[model samples]
Target: MRRSLIALSLAIVASTSLTAAARADIKSPVVIATEGAYAPWNLTDSAGKIVGFEPELIDYICKRAKLECTIVAQDWDGMIPGLIAGKSDVIMDAISITPEREQIIAFSNPYARTKAGFLTARDGKFAKADGTGSTLVTTPTLNNAADTLKSLRAKLSGASIGIQTGTVYAEFIEKNFGDIATIREYRTNDERNLDLENGRLDLAFEDTVVLMPTVEKANGALEFTGPAFGGTLFDAGSGFGFRKGDDELKAAFNAGIAAALADGTIKALGEKWLKADVSP
Candidate 1:
């Protein structure tokens, strides 16, 4: 913990002074970044081995692409800047594609799509406004979001929801449920789970796959509710993220991603790790 904090502090302190120099020759053989704290996505297990979905998938893709690459464990916030500062070459984290991010960087074709969902402990009840719905209903495209939001509003009248800061999921909950419930932001899922376990927050909203390994590892302390959500609000999928202007690398990764999808490697890995084929 102390070492990571020191590294994070150093990255921030030296970022501005080193940004231009680091980003100069980013076409190196190795790219690096964090696993983004999603279990089975990217995490260090008990043996201190960096093992997870992205690490394994990227290893396969890099081999297919014939690119010499090295993967490392870094902080999520520093991942982008690490790329910008030439600290790493590729970030295999579960980075989502977004228009805003496009302004600053590029992304390879998506390898996976994990839908959004909310989780509230198996305890708690609240008076309803009308129909008395208690869970988030999957809406591909909510034409009447206001009406549907009332269900969440009714159930969470006085409850609190936890989310990771600076994410689309956080935005979703805030834009829709901010008026109804208190929103608490955590730096990582483990912290948020601690909050959930301790009753500090009533619920959490995030991707189902991102939460999968957590659920499996929990041995039944936490549980999910209702169907997975997607559409315009939740975004389409997760993909390989590249820095801006890195066209060659992005295209190479996209080709590898397409090939993996066709060969069933991605589906097989999804099933092996997550117990479900997340092919969408």
Candidate 2:
């Protein structure tokens, strides 16, 4: 009876040790969410796998940060809510790091910088607008921003403009041009692109990185017009977004992004995918 009791006690100790060991091995992997419809940033391939510039950059970031990560596709409108609800551990959808967004969620250091511009039909009325191909930086705080927006509004007045919902571009349009121009919001950039292609939209505002490739593929059907706006609404550029309290994850990503930027990994990826060096 004594021997049996001793044996049972030993067995229980061993089982407890095994349980602890198993718990130690159970490390959580970071799950990244992105909108697969934003080409050059991210997009679903023919095989239904998410691929693009952001994916490649995130792979490098995860490797540098020693994180096991899985990238998943989510709609643009759901990205922030999904992160807040714990549905995703991170967001790598080229989300601009804007002040308005900062009030809701935290952001890592910017990974890339690009300007926003308008895309219009090649022979459209606004194709030769005064600001075509010019780079303009404006922010709500700038003293001259009101005048600039007034001029821009006049250029786009009475026109139909399409923008992706839940983006800074949408906000910019609503604030500056909504009163004069007809604003159409779509769920995805692809949808907006289709409407623009179908002649349903007079102009479309989007990242120049995204716009350039699309214009190239359009084969003269489309051309970039108006000033390329940066700063302010566009944020300090694009960054990885996390829940407001996830400081540890935010720090890890920021470090990894710094490393990637220092090593030129992001620049190479940006040039390869965006055809420009958009690394911040």
Cα lDDT computed for each candidate against the true fold: 0.65, 0.75
lDDT of 2 at 164: 83
Compose the digit string of candidate 2's lDDT tens values, residues 136-183: 777656564666666777777899989887787788778778889899
lDDT (Cα) of model 1: 0.65
121-192, model 1: which lDDT tens digit per residue?
A: 554453223332233344435664566566657767777888887677887788878987899988777888
Tell me the TM-score of model 2: 0.87
